[model samples]
Target: MGADREGGARRRPMRAVACAAWGILLLAGCASMPDSGDLRDVESTPRQDTEVRVFAMPPRENAPPAEIVQGFLEALTSDDPQYATARQYLTPTASRRWRPESSTTVLADGWDIEVDRATAHEDSGDYAFTLTGSKVARVDEQQSYTPLDGRYSQSVHLARDKSGQWRIDTPPQGVLMGRSDFQRNYMPVNKYYFASDTAGGTGRPATAVADPVYVRQRVDAMTRVVRSVISGPTRWLDRVVRSSFPTGTALRRDVTALAPDDQNRLTVPLNEKASRVGSERCWEMAAQVLFTVQNLTPTVETVALQRADGSTLCTLGADRARTVATRGPVKRPEYLYFLDDKRRLVRILGGTAGTSVEPVPGGLGEGLQRLSSAAVAWDERTAAGVSNDRKDLYVGSLVQGGTLGNAVLRSDGKTEDDRLTAPSWDARGDLWVADRDPARPRLVVLEQGKGRPVEVTVPGLDGRVDAVRVAADGVRVALLVQHKDGTESLLVGRIERDGRSGERTAVSVLGLRPAAPDMEDVTAMSWAGDSRLVVAGREQGGVQTMRYVQVDGSTPDVPAPAALTGVKSIAASDDERLPLVAYSEADGLVRMSSVAQWQKVVKEGAAPVYPG
Candidate 1:
């Protein structure tokens, strides 16, 4: 009864006067007299628009235990502010203790309610029901969503009040709802913060990293997102990112419902704790706010920070904020590079189809050392290519008279398939590659493509690394791992560097989590945006398909990209304006245009990649 019962046989008829208020009209037959020969269920179409608000009905007088439980579950999924109606089903003490906003548990389907035969009976003063469902994910008090796969079972106790009305005395602490309702009621927004090590100055702009969180869509989202940004980054990203706001920073007392003015300017009044910061730090704080707010609404063009006493701290416009804290790649890639038919590095103008393909300006492009796969640095000034046999890796300059040097690294894997995968570069200019040697597999990083290769320690790793892709942020790395049973999964790990100043550092990849848990076999993947990756993989019993998944292990609300067959490798830019390029076995090297159609770029090319 706790599940969605609107389409069930137990549907209740609404009063005529309340029909219009609910935005639905109930029609009843007045002249029906004949008995039905065949019984068929009549189904009502569900609302597809999120802007349509659904209000929960209050509990009926003298309601039974089951109805009270069902009504409470329904109310949790409504757009009612503060869930006032839902609390009515609970006793005063339980209502006060319940914090619906504390967290949200989302199930694959609405919860099932069944009375406990051991203690529940019609004449019993207290009744107990077990609510159960398959837990799919959860959003904590911080609004951070983490994927889960397990069963959820909670006991809900109801007792008869003095007036003989049933009320819940033991309700779940936080609200629980189905996945469909959660998606409809909440929206994901990115809160921005500066990378810890990349503080702006000295010819380098501090890079902004996106921390995504879910918030109720119609519930003063602007103010909630602003408060979340001020609170600081989530625990997972707190180590690698930092906020410019001072300790104990918060919004001014009595401040709520922050909205932009007619001029598209947002003024945020901070508490006294943030009042003493210098002008430069205040501007950085404003940059964080400006970047975070822009993702929520496009109308906000500028953000002005104010002290508790109403004195202006700093003001930042969208244009200046970008200069202070840049997002994504520092420089746009000029060309999409890949290996040609002869295993030589070649390139074509990015985002353009039918353009003349030319060999890149570097020694690797001369075809002297046939290459299997390659990656170009973000600056487009250097390139790293794996040898045709996939054993030796070479790094060379992209200059007119550049010459190929000796292989900087090598793998001892007996066969090509178990050797070095394609290399990738991060914004910090460091190169990352994975060696799939079964005897001794390792994830290695070249510090600025020089010095000894740092073998990254991946704790809790249960498989060998097959492919590697480092994100533009330089704080996260994505790896395609092959399990013992031969199944491959896509995982993202946090890149941590620890050591003393001016001393040798220890680099490791920690907290490896599945980014595409449902994909049975991930053939390829690429970072498509700040926190989104475009993955090509197959489900347990499904065919290969390409979809976007967030680094936090959640699927995005947007539609999947157009399907391409036999995708061997894929390439995408953090800049969404650029088209997606991939090497498909059926169609050769191809790129998806702005119109969502794949256009052939070359008849024979592989390992398509954009400068990381």
Candidate 2:
């Protein structure tokens, strides 16, 4: 009876549909499926102009203090050129004081703002409000990106004017907007900075360094980007990087905008202050300008520097500009390394037709077995790995006939999951590892030629450090930390070392910040290019995906090609053009080349790794 009743109820919807369609064809419920050959993918979304403007509602006449404040905040997200609409909510004095270009604080959406009414007093009409939200990143006065995490609060006060209208009497400088508004209002562009390879002895050619920063998409973006490059690196990077632009540098007084000629030649006029640099420094400065501008408009193939007198001081073309001070002495690796089916180290050399897979030579190549994870040094002379039992970490020579030394490090974890993570070797030959033993977690660095490991402290991390990868520069370290809440976070922190003294050195992590906050369950990450990391993770607890993210935690506008699903590990060289290598469940080990397609490189491999 229940089955029949259920069948009757199910047929009621079909009967109603057929009855409703009787006038047309009386076959609505029996419509045939479309032909398989006729099926098509949805049309791609139309590309949007980078400088497109977003409109915001204007302020109403004689609005209350809270309403005026809300309108002003909303208008800040729109492209009003000079923020004319937003200024209406401010007093004349405050309007002149509020400089929207001073800085930008990007907040996550869905922030709740509370407005507190004032009690009846001498300033009874005054109102106070508080803003609270997650800080994603900040563009300082110099327009450099600084990754920020945690909640932020600001108290804003508003007052009623004598004309019976509310206005902001004291307003803050710059602007604050949600990430959604920020995406619509601003676009990211690269600014060039010179290489500061503190660990350069490993023998690798110098490569380009592109510092990603955000600028107003449409409002004089070219001019703004160039000026920002001349302003020098951001505060977080100022001490670790160098710039060619001299102090007090600026554009020529007569020129208001940077324009390219028909033949694709862009001429930038500098004030007398910037003309004092030497020829080599001048070339670097030109390269900086060229890289910054070309990132915006491709029409500019060449750039010429001019003086206040309109005289051409120097000219740099695309070919020579990219080579300026960017070449190092070592060749990049042609093969991606990994662990073979026998748990021995192996490699797959990439080529045009296909790749040749072979086992690496040496004790690690033929003798070592049951390896869980590994890392090859930047010099390609040494390697490190953890035993399958997860109790021993070994360092050995990477060349043929080389020996796998006794376990240099050991784990105390009682379970396999709590064992040591994969070892990573820095450019300076220092091997880093994290013992994930829940009973006694630790982060240690095995300096070259040292018997014991040095413990490094991660000050503010409220979790266990799971993995570690130090940058080639030896100044920054990337850490995969498992938080107390059972979620993993990717963090980058500065590696602060004690000044060179007569005694031995000490190093610790300070000012640790999130590098990929938008991602959860990040399984693997590698340095893909300067200040950029290619990460593999599941976002929002969905299927795993691979993407390139900035070290400053800002997502790029142009998305990277998606990696094959279920990629267990990923490896990338600092050279951005080189293909990325990964190990997946279906396609053993594959290489993702320039075409953004995965080609099988190794038939059976696991734990793929690349030299730093």
lDDT of 2 by residue, 236-295 (tens): 666545677888888887777777899888888999987666666677788788877887
Clashes of each: 0, 3
Question: What are the per-residue Cα lDDT tens digits for candidate 1 across 1-612?
Answer: 343222232212111111233667543321221222321232211323654565677777776777777678777877776999889989998999999988999888667675676667658788887777789889999898888889998888999887888899999769898787788778889899988888754456788899989999877889999999999999888988989999899999979689999999999999999999987788789988888888889779999999999999999998887778788888788889988999999998885665688998879999999998999999999999999999999999998789998999999999999899999998888999999998999999998987789899999888899999998989889999998887888889888888763576788898888889888778899999888999998976999999999998888898888999988899999987789988888999888887889888888899999997
Residue 80 alpha-carbon offset, candidate 2, angstroms = 3.7
lDDT of 1 at 81: 68
Q: Which stretches of model 1 miss by more than 4 angstroms? A: 1-47, 200-203
Clashes of 1: 0
On a 0 to 1 TM-score scale, where does candidate 2 land against the true structure?
A: 0.77
> Residue 392 of model 1: what lDDT?
92
Give each model a TM-score.
0.92, 0.77
Model 1 local distance difference test score: 0.84
